[model samples]
Target: MLKLLNQLLGLFCCFLMTACSSVPKLESNAIAPIVKLPNNHEELGVMSAYSDPWEGFNRRMYYFNAKADEYVILPVVAGYQKITPDVVERSVHNFFSNLDEISTFINSLLQLKLFVAGETLARFTLNSTLGLAGLFDVATQIGLAEQNEDFGQTLGYWGVDAGPYLVLPLLGPSSLRDATALAFDNLVFQQAINELGLDTDEELLISLIDGVDARASLPFRYYASGSAFEYEHLKLLYKKYREIQVAR
Candidate 1:
C-alpha cells in the first residue's frame, strides 16, 4: 500500500516535469556569460559530461516509471477527461495550484525573497476569498502573477549543490538535494492538510483526484518526444531548467 501511494505520487511529479520539458532558448550572447562551455563543444562530449553516476539504476527506474504511466495513469486520466466537464477540470487545477501557493510562499520567505513572499501571500489571500477558494485565478487577472518557489530553490539560494542526478521509481528526474526538498515539502503539505481538518481518507482521495486532473491537463507522453536520445535530453533539460529557476 505504501508502494502504491508512492507510485501515485509519482504521476503528479512526472506530469509536472514532463509538462515543463521544453528547453528555453538561450541567447547566443548570454551563453558565454552563463554556461561558458568551450567554443569547440562536441555533442558526444557534452552528453557524456552530464553527471549520472547512478545511470544503471536510474535507467531501470525510468523504464518502470514510463511503463506505469503508460498503463495505469494515462488510462485513468483519459477516463477522467472523458467524463469531467472542462470547467470543473480547470477548477480542480486552480484549487490544487492555490494550495501549492502556501508552500511557495514559505519557501520564498526562507530564501529571503521578501517581494516574492509578499506577492505569494497576497495571491493566496485574494484567490482564496475573491476567487472562491481558487476556483478562479483572480490574482493573475488582477496582475498578481503567481510566483513559483520551492525548498529546492531555497537550498539553491543558500549555495547548496545539486548533488547528483537521480531518477525516482515513479517521480521522474530529480537530484539528491531536490529529492530531499521534495520530501520536506510533502511533509509540510501534509501538515497543512491536517490543519484543514481533512481525514486520511479525504487526503488520499484528493491526492488521487489531483493526480488524475494533473495528468489529464498535461500533453506529455512517455517516449513521445521522437528524439533517439530522449533520456539524455530529458536529463539535460531538467538540469538546465532547475538552474534557470534557481538563477531567477
Candidate 2:
C-alpha cells in the first residue's frame, strides 16, 4: 500500500509545479543560454553513455511500470477528468503542492539552505492560512516561489553517491540513494497520517485520490516520445536532470 501511495504522491507533486508554467517555445534563437537538442538526438545512440549496472532488473521494472500506466493509471485519470471541473482540479493541485512544501522545507534545512528553507516555510505558512489551506497559491504571485527540494537532493548535497540506477515499478526513474530517501519520506508521511487517527483504508484512499489528481494534471503520455528506445532516452534524461538538480 505504501509503495502504491508513494508512486501516486510523486505523480501529484510532479505536475503541481509544472501545471501553471507556460509551455516552452519549440523554436530557439542562437543567443539562447540553453542549447536546443533535436528530438532525434537519441538516434545517434547517445543513451549508450548512461551506465546502468543493474540494467536487467531495471528494464523489467520499466516494463511493469509502462503496463501499469496503460492498463490502470490512464483509465482512472480519464474518468477523473470527466468528473472534475477545471477549477476544482486546479484547487486540488494547489492543495497538494502546498502540502509538499512541508517535505521541501525539511529537506532544505537538512541541506542547510537557509534562504530556501525560510522561503519554503514562509510559503507554507502564508498559503496554508491566507490561501485557504493551500487550495490557492497566493504566495506565488507575491514571489515566494516554490523550492522543489527532496531528501534525494539533500543526500546529494551531502556528497552521497547515487549508488546505482533504478527503475521502480510505477515509481519511474530513481537512484539507490533517491529510493532510500523516498522510502524515508513515505514512512514519515504515513506516520503523520496515522497520528491523525485515520484508519488504513482512509489513508490508502487519500493516497489514491492524490495520485489520481496528479496523474490527471500531467501533460505527458507514456512512450509518446516516439523513440523505439524510449526507456533508455528517459533513463538518460532522468540521470542528467538529477545531476543538475543536485548541483543547484
Candidate 3:
C-alpha cells in the first residue's frame, strides 16, 4: 500500500512540474552550458572509448526508455484530470509526511541520528486507516509533520558526495552518487518487497507503471513560463534542487 501510494504521489509531483510549465522554444544553444561535459568527462569518455558496444547499448536503451516514458506514460496521466492540482499537491505533502515517519522508523533501526523514525507511526497508522488510506490530512492534526527523503539523501547521510553531474540517457539528469544511490535503493526495496511476499514480476511492473503515473501527475508549472531557455532552465533548477536534497 505504501509503495503504491508513493508511486501515485510521485507521478502527481512530476505532473505538477510538467503541467504547470509552458513549453518554451527548444534552443540548441541553451543546452551548451548545462550539457557541457564536466571535468570528470573522462569517466564517461573512458566508458565510451574502451567499451563502445556497451555504451552504445546503454544509450539505445536509455532513448527507448525515455520515449516510452513520454509517449506511453504521460498521456495516460494527462487523462486523469480528476486528480487535480490541489489534490495532487496535498497528497504529495501527506505522502511525504508518512514517509518521514517511515524514515524515522528505518533510521531508528539503522541507528542513524539524522532523523527521528517511528514517532509518526501512530499518525501514519491513523491516517492510513481513518484518513482513507493517506489521501487526506489527518496526520497533520496531531502534529505528525511530513519529512521527505530519497535514496540521494540517504547516500548523503552516509557521507557520499555528489560527484560530477551526468545526463543519463532515459533516467535524465543525476550525479554519479545519486545514480548509485538509486540502484542501492532499488535493491533494498526489492528485498523488502520479497520479504513481504510481493516481489513478483507483475508486482514490479505495476510499481514501475505507478512511478511513471506519479511523475506524470505533477503539474508542469514551469514549462509554460514563456522562457526561451526552458530546457536549460529546468536542468539548472533540478540540479540545484537535487544538490539541496543531497545536502539536507
Best by TM-score: 1
Candidate 1 lDDT over residue span 58-150, tens digit each? 889988988999999888888888898999888988988888889999999998999999999999999999999888999999899887788
Give the CA lDDT, 0 to 100, for residue 155 in model 2.
Answer: 93
Clash totals for all models, in order? 0, 0, 33
Report the Cα lDDT for residue 159, model 2.
Answer: 97
The segments of candidate 2 whose C-alpha lies over 4 angstroms from its true place after superposition are: 1-46, 191-197
Error of 3 at 13 (Å): 14
Question: Which digits, one per residue and each the tens of the lDDT, describe model 2 over residues 10-52?
Answer: 4443433332222245566545538666665545444555679
Residue pairs with clashing backbones, model 2? none
* TM-score for each predicted model, relative to the true structure: 0.81, 0.78, 0.55
Which ranking of candidates, highest TM-score first? 1, 2, 3
The per-model lDDT (C-alpha) reads 0.77, 0.75, 0.52
lDDT of 3 at 33: 50
Order of candidates by lDDT, top first?
1, 2, 3
After best superposition, candidate 3 residue 118: deviation in angstroms?
4.3
